[model samples]
Target: TMYELVGKEMTDKWTPPWPFGKKPTILQLDELGMTDVPQAERVNDAIDDAKVETAVLQDILPDVGFGFGSGRAVGSNNWVIGGNTTKSGMPLLANDPHLGIQMPSIWYVVGLHCKPIDGSPPFDVTGFALSSSPGVIIGHNSHIAWGVTNVNPDVFDLYRIKVNPANPLQYEWNGAWRDIKVRQETINFGDGQSPVTIQVRETHLGPIINDNKVDKETGEIQGFNNKDPMALHWTALESGTILKAVTGLNEATNWEEFREALKYWDVPSQNFVYADVKGNVGYQTPGRIPIRAKHHSGLLPVPGWTNEFEWQGFIPFDKLPTVFNPKRGYVATANQAVVPLEYYDMLASELGEGENYAISQEWDYGYRGQRIIELLEKLAPHSIETLQVLQGDNKLISAEELIPYLGRLRFNEPELNEARDWLMKWDYQFDMDSPQAALYAEFWMQLANNLFGDQLPEQIKLEGWAREMWAAYLLMEQPNDTWWDDASTSDVVETRDDILVRSFREGYNNAVATLGNDRSRWRWGNLHTSTFVSNPLGRSGVSFIEKMVNRGPYPTSGCTGTVNNTRWTVHSGSFAVDHLPSMRMIVDLGDLTRSVAIHTTGQSGHPYSKHYDDMIELWRNIKYHPMLWTRAQVEAAAANKLILKPAN
Candidate 1:
């Protein structure tokens, strides 16, 4: 049906043809011994069919893994304000990396200081580091302070492999049979269980992540029936000098050295924000982003038998996005698109390209970035106190964008009209104590479901926040669009206004039912809460163990896309916060001693330790502890110290 709707060229060249016609399936081709068909064409056909099937299955099947919570709102918020915009007359840098809420938090705060030795640069850094990682992931050295947010680059691709029918160990490459390299990996259990081993097949492209297709009922891997196995080509898999880059960053003095250090950062690309004692602010995007073929969009799997869709090497480090002391006096990134369209044009012109210079299509919705910019511009001459307050902002731009539509809708019921009036007079903040926030949250969720739930598949349905915001905004101009009509109701054609009124009434009723008839008692915090859960123990299923290991379902503010991002899943039909700012940090180059930071949980990993959950209240309340930088300050704040000795 989709194939007929889209027509032949669009389906054949771009999207896969849906509801596959009489075209021979992958298994059928192998069984019938269709060697006359070109391997490249055969593989492409198989890939198309597989893509269509996967799409269909994803639509109908219940979501696997974390279900609705699987798409935990991603991306971090980081910004740097130059001396001109700060009260201290020196740059100020703020960062809050958004991540899943957990105990023994993702970050381990530490201050590493090493005096210059053996003609090496002095190393003095303070900030957050991954518990398992070596150097400071985001922090400030003596001369400069830096923060990082994910760049969200498209640095990986899937290549559909065409296996040789004669020998399963071989695959087609440029019309010739190439041996598929097999690596044996054994998993040894700690409890003395039998070691299980499996063969990992690899092509020149990369490892075959999706190997032979298996029958769901029989649980048998049908070897020959698997016509096209996909091999993954990811930048992270390639050997990189990320460790070298980390060490370099820890010791780097100025913008020049900072830029030089980032050259070695090859994987997990990041937008590095810089602020130094020299009153400078800068931004740099560094990583090995692949330059793809002109025809390939990198959105779907391509034929591995041919070199047409192969990557044409990486974008040069020097050519990557960078800004030094911008005219705006500030730099910020929230996993949004880094470069402008003009940047791509310039890159193409300079590179003399028949290749696509487009870095990635998968960037954030830019809501956080926009908010950060808005604050930075509106509230200039910022100080440590002001910046700290800014980090706690819970205003939702999505609400601001969509709430106006509700004002125009006329409700029939008196209660519905009263609820609409109350919502209309409210500020768009997801404050913990706000009753209007609670009502609006429920209304927003209901509106999203009413609009797209019946039309789109379960997996692809809009689940409120950014996706729904964008959809509603676009559809607002087209009142008579087919999507506005309720698919479930055939007798009555509902317009956008009709759906809005219906959703409002339903949302009001639902909120009243959940929070009671008294509207004033409906506080956002009652439903929207945060739980700092411990791994293994918290999920052990025993009530006592869970209560002992997990922190409170604490009242919290903010929603998805807010600066104070405490994310909850609407698809789960629960308002409990699933993700939040993993760690918050503010660095004042004007006064490093004044800098402060805090993570979701405390420093200690031990569940029984008092330090385990000490910082929870402070983090939730947007409060912070001083980031001790100087030796004197560190010594003053030290509660206990341990000494190391060499075993003679």
Candidate 2:
């Protein structure tokens, strides 16, 4: 879908950090051997394959609905620029990783100063860390500041293996029968009933994920049949250096040290952007990217009977896309392909014929990235305040592009004509109170349904790959491209105008009913509100505990591509934004103490604690709090402190 929209030329264009002019393929990168990155099955693929059991699938959901896998479609935006592009003579960096909303929070704010042991300098770190971990996943120290968004490369692959009919425990592997490894785990129920035991089988490839049950009578495998057993091999399972790598990162002093530190950083590979007070900025993707054996791309399930499908080591760290201070002055990424096209030829050779390896095949549309670049290029000398404001910009550029096409559609209905006229004068911003934003959003949805609902189901059509720019391109460039013709209506081949008029009428009538007949009341915030709920409990049910923990129904702005990517759910066609920046960070290299940041919920998990939802209001208002770094600033801001002494 992305290829159809941007075309291979623009999608594969060469970017900075790639030293050579020559296009390199995955095969070429594999020759260098990078060796470690986080890996997960693309969630869509996992869903479509239907091999994942409902129970395991539920685990991914408590975080994001259907967390089948991590892909670029639902990711983040990050960028860094050199001092020349900044008002102050210091580099600047910003990051906001979008994820599902939850309470008790997913991030922990902390300041750590590990005293020097022996001759080493103290490891002074600050900023947000995963609530479960100690080291900073994205933060800054006195010398350098860094942030990350997922580098959603295709690192996980599913394989279909042939299970031996005579020996159910054996599977065919590279021309021989390989025995499956079984591990048993016992579950305790506290009550007197017997504990349940599960037998998990591991193949040479990885884990036999499809087999969920064993028949008690005959011992035959149940859920996933033996004929087509599915095994999942992920990069995360094989990589173990992430802890060490992140630890190294927390102590690194400069770009070189940071780069060196990342070599050990593996699972859930991320694009790391860095800026130091020394006036330096850079971007590096650190992870293990497998080189699929010839004739096999990682997009789908491959047979595991032969060695041809095995991975050939990995793409070396140096080959991972990296860029130092470029002449262009700024580096930006929005989960879109950061690698330029010049390197495609070399890498293209690695993929099968007619195949393209997107940095992450599931990347979101480039609207956000394009918008960020436009702003950066326009405001060359960026100030901290300006950049902070820019991070929350909600200008819907896609609406601007669509307005021209919509203007040309002929409408007869008076209400439709009036709606069209109103839209023509509308500002392309999804600000919370903008009625125009509501109109455009609803209109776009209806138009898309009218155009493609006949050919594709809502589930597939609404995916990021099919809905964003790809649909925009079709509406603008190929209005009469047969796709507009509803296959169900064979009586006539409907033209673009026919579909547009029908969709406009539908959207207008719906908007009137929902927002009231008064056109002025159709505010985006009325429908597009954000909610941060408790994990598992959601905002609704939780054994009578919803009132104490869940937050929001708060009005918000922005959609998938805007700087604030708060996406609403499709349920009942209501606009309850559930996905947005879990945390936002803007680093001021010129003055670490001047930097500002905010996370969705608060620092304390206790619902009664004052810090529980203190930051929620600020986040809902698109505001930020200072990231106090110096001891004096931290002490001044500290309301209470506790000193822990060693046991006597």
Which residue pairs of candidate 1 clash?
none
lDDT of each: 0.76, 0.70
Candidate 1 at 607: error in angstroms? 1.3
Estimate, for each residue in 1-648, the C-alpha lDDT of model 1 and write its tens digit: 234443443233222232122111111222222323433332233334332212332332232111002221467788899888888788999998888788778889999988889998777999988765689989998899998877767776778898887787888888899998988878687556787666778888988876545579996655433465778787766798888888889989999999999999887788789989988888888889898777676656689988888899999998887878877677777766565434555566678557777666555556677777778788888998888888998888878887888888777777787888889888888889989999988887787788766665444434565545655766777787676789899998989998888888888888888899999899999889998888878887899999999998899999987889888776778888877888999999988999999998899988889899999999999999999999999999889999889998
TM values, all candidates: 0.88, 0.85
Best by lDDT: 1
In Å, residue 24's CA in model 2 sits off its true spot by 18
Give residue 612's lDDT in candidate 2 (0 to 100): 89
**Runs of candidate 2 exceeding 4 Å displacement:** 1-69, 185-196, 213-224, 346-359, 457-461, 464-467, 487-492, 537-544, 569-572
lDDT of 2 by residue, 1-648 (tens): 223443333223211112112211211222223233222223223222221112222222222211112433467878898888888878989988888777866888788887899998798989888755668888998789998877667677777889999987889987899998988868787447677777777887988876756678996546435866777778776747877887888999988999999999766667788899899988888877776554454655678888777877667787677777766677787766555443434454444333333344444456677678888888778877778777888986667777877788767667787789899998788889898888877777777666655654223324332134445454556556566788788898987778877777887887888889888877898878877777655544554688777777788888756877887543336667767888888998998888989998888888788998999889877789998888899889989999999999
lDDT of 2 at 632: 98
